[model samples]
Target chain A: MFNNPVTSLAHVKTGRLRALAVTTAKRASSLPDVPTAAESGLAGFDVGFWLGALAPAGTPRPIIDRLNAEMVKAVQMSEVLERLGALGVEPIGSTPESFARTIDAEATRWAKVIKDAGVKAD
Target chain B: MTSLRRMRCANDRLGGARVALVAAALFAANVAAQQAYPSRAIKIVVPFAAGGPSDVMARTLAQRLNVAFGQPVVVENRTGAAGAIGAEYAAKSAPDGYTLLLAQVGDTISMSLVPNLPYNFQKDFAPISLVGQTAFILVTHPSVPANNLRELIALAKSKPGALTFGSSGAGAASHLAGELLKGMAGVDILHVPYKGRRLPPLIC
Candidate 1:
């Protein structure tokens, strides 16, 4: 019915991207890099998450460690990973150590951008 | 003797006053504590916005639960960043079970999509029964003139960078699905994003 909202289909249902790709492959092999007039006219969009925990400076490390450990285990189960992949998603399954590093890097990246652009969240 | 009688009268009044004050204070404290967990009305925090499947499910569930709990279990919409606002509110609530959250599969997706959410779905929330899951049909715009996936692929390949598709937004399942299609089919379907539900027959 050409019924799906472009944004929800594009962003929220990202997991189904893999299956969609398989289907689209049978229809057309090559497509455009930018939205067509018709595509833009539709209402569908999404944004990815880059932020995480923001506890007070002195929160215990043990708590973070335990949570991250559980998260890794939950994300790594074969059923979970397969389900995520089938949804066109790849998991990081990172440890607190790695997650900390990514968090630091993200902070640095965003800090620089904020400094350069003078961006502030209201 | 007259002074003594006056002092006794004053003492009786003072004692009566003190007793009344203490009793009033205790009553107030008990009432404050008993502010009825479900007080006036309760809100079930549905992570998604109103009108979506999750929202609908939550509202319907809230209605049924309200019937059982004998309180107005209102469905509050706190949509943003893919249910983060709703989840965070539920996590920070008084663990009294009055402020409930309706979580779905996207709970996991948000962990990856928005890595730094304030709350953890598994930790912050007590395990509630799993809701339901919905399977979607992979339909395309009829204007594409592709009868099947094969024809669609050929048309896309022949006119690479010429065709486009719509997605809810970046990192959304629909968006990722489009990206996956681009990556796997080796086609470059341009993605157009929006900020609403992707299902058909929307109420504009």
Candidate 2:
């Protein structure tokens, strides 16, 4: 079964489920002992479930900037950091430009994967 | 007759001036409303069901945003159609900084798989800061013999169509992750997709 660390970490920790590997480029901080898929002999096997913020396209730039500033600050807060960290989630408070770039890159990367694998919407 | 024509022209000019004044006043009011952002509740649309990871993350951010802006920041779950419903709702909403979508990687993937989606992911949304990322762990029931990814791949290769992996749903991140693993490992393991948030225990 493939599940995010938030829901599956406890089962993995308690020995109920045997974690084969994390499907991310970096090893999870909470499960440092577990090897990443790439390290486990599948090179370039990076698949992370990333979350980001977005508003409608016509939203003013100033408002977007304000939201970004507050979000970046909030994610870095000690309480937020600790809460996310325990679930093996990495806090990334990136600028809007960088986030847009990530979205573009991910869209391209996953589109090819879906096409190659013949994945259809259900 | 000339005086009557002059009087009509004067009335037309007066009407135009009144129209301009009202337009200016409305524009000013709109600007004032925008400047005082979050004058009312700000909603974050989570495309998934409540108590899911996306919802949890949105609520976490909402709490902080509420405190920072001194206005209510709410998380609205608009779940359905593998997150398309909420995404479309957010996309068509007024771009006044009050409506936002807690977007996930699934949304980007849906662009390729789901055809004729109402809004384009890149064109309809403005990117904001990335919140956080969680790694998906591939786990198996304790009874499986494979201890690592390599062993599991070998096991699947040996018993090609016999082993099956379960996912949260069709076209979900988990399902795609399973597909990626299949493509990378060059194995023929079957994919079993479960519906909704409840995932049955791994049977393979």
Best by TM-score: 2
- Give per-residue CA lDDT, model 1, range B1-204, as digits (tens): 999999999999999999999999987865554454335565677767676756655554555555544778788788886778888987887654456666654455455556478986545555333332332224554445564455666777888887776645554544554454455456766655555544432111
Pairs of residues clashing in candidate 2:
none
lDDT of each: 0.48, 0.89
Best by DockQ: 2
TM-score of each: 0.46, 0.85
| Candidate 1 CAPRI grade | incorrect
- lDDT tens string, model 2, B1-204? 999999999999999999999999988977787789878999999999887768878988999999999999999999988899999999999999999999999988999989999999989999998888988899998899999989999999899889988988778888889888899889987888888668645737
lDDT of 2 at A84: 77
Q: First chain TM-score in every candidate? A: 0.43, 0.86
Best by lDDT: 2
Question: Candidate 2: deviation at residue B183, Å?
Answer: 1.2
DockQ of each: 0.05, 0.70
Report, for candidate 1, the interface RMSD: 11.9
